[model samples]
Target: MQNQESEQVVRHPFGKFTYLLCSILTLLVGTAFMGSSRVSVMLFCLLFSTVLLTAVVSVCHRHKTLGIGLTLVVLMLILNVSSFLTRSYSLTVLHNSLVIIFLAFVFYHILSAVFHDDRVTLDTIIGTVSLYLLAGLLWSYLYSTILLVDPAAFRYDLVNAASEAVTLRNSDLQPLIYLSFVTMATLGYGDIVPVSGPAQTACYLQAVFGQFYFAILVSRLVAMYISAATHKNQQHAQGS
Candidate 1:
């Protein structure tokens, strides 16, 4: 009975949701780079929103405070759909605001899972990967917001016969998403550069965060694994 309880305690709730998130994020990144049509982008947005809401509800169902917050986020996401369809600039701001809020909630949940006291499980690893992907998504929305306000924030090189340099704008988010991950991973391709001061600052901050997160996560996980193993060995010795 005690062993069963221990196993149950270690079971994380977001494992399946984490897999779904990863798959959707991969598709979104691919679509972004392929120059997908506006309709396709909208479809992806719809799918993403739905999956995000479901994941939040699944992870936060038991916590009263998080559940209430999830309800508000759902309402905001619903409004975002209409605003997205109509292309209302004011509503777009509201939509972006809601997205940032939702991402924050999800980040909190992922951190909870990562720092869980019990033995590290498969779900913990999945949650960690989800957190990394979420970081990219968060930065993508931020860059998108910055570009919306300032059209000349980022400079893009023209790869083809076009002589003029392309400035980043809010029309398509694929490049921004790609740029976010590239910057987060410290892969400076030089194809897309943040020319504005604010943009440069944001990229530098993200790079530092990426390095810090990985270093801390690795050390924490290794420590937890060793502790769990030592405890188990001691238990076996006592039982014998």
Candidate 2:
């Protein structure tokens, strides 16, 4: 029996993060290099928000959250369309805010799943990575919103193509997304610096949060891995 068991290869099942992470990478890489134009940025947000909302909710498989996601997606579509037709800044901001909420919602649910697991599985590890990425995305939305409200919040090379009315057109969304991830990793690449008081505060707070999250998650994963191994050993002894 032992030899037969040793001969069989163990396969790990794909977890919640597997497909969702794939979608995120695909969308981020595919849309990031599309263009720096305002229209392209908005289109990227639309596609990404829809994909994120749809993908995250699939993990819980809850009908209620699924319904809520569908509603948000519809509203997002409507708002995007209206913003284009009427050229309303309020509609645009509202759309971005809703996307932020969707991200927070997903982050909360994923964390809940991580805590609920007793054993350290592949999904749990992937969940941790997903949480980290989701956090960066959430902060990216916040930074974008702040930039929209205050053009001078961040001082970066703004003459990328014809993006003179930077805040109004939201051509800096991609740059802010880059800033978000960089800040979270505490890279401090001064290519784009936050000048305003609010922006500076946000950057520092994100740096701290990112560090705490990494330390805590690593400990949690280690503890769970040990517990799982111990439990397996007990079961083996009992079977003997």
The digit string of per-residue lDDT tens for model 1 on 42-148 reads: 66666666657655654575678567667767777777677767877767766776677777777787788678747777777777777787888788878877777
Quality of model 2 by C-alpha lDDT: 0.76
Enumerate clash totals for all models, in the order shown. 0, 0
lDDT of 2 by residue, 1-240 (tens): 987665553442566677777667766676667776666757776668656664555455778878776777778778777876687889878977987887887888888888999888888888888788778878887887777788788877445477563332254456777888899999987878888888898899999999999798878899889988999999999999
Candidate 1's error at 91, in angstroms? Answer: 2.0
**Backbone clashes in model 1, listed as residue pairs:** none
Clash count for candidate 1 is: 0
TM-score of each: 0.82, 0.82
lDDT values for all models: 0.75, 0.76
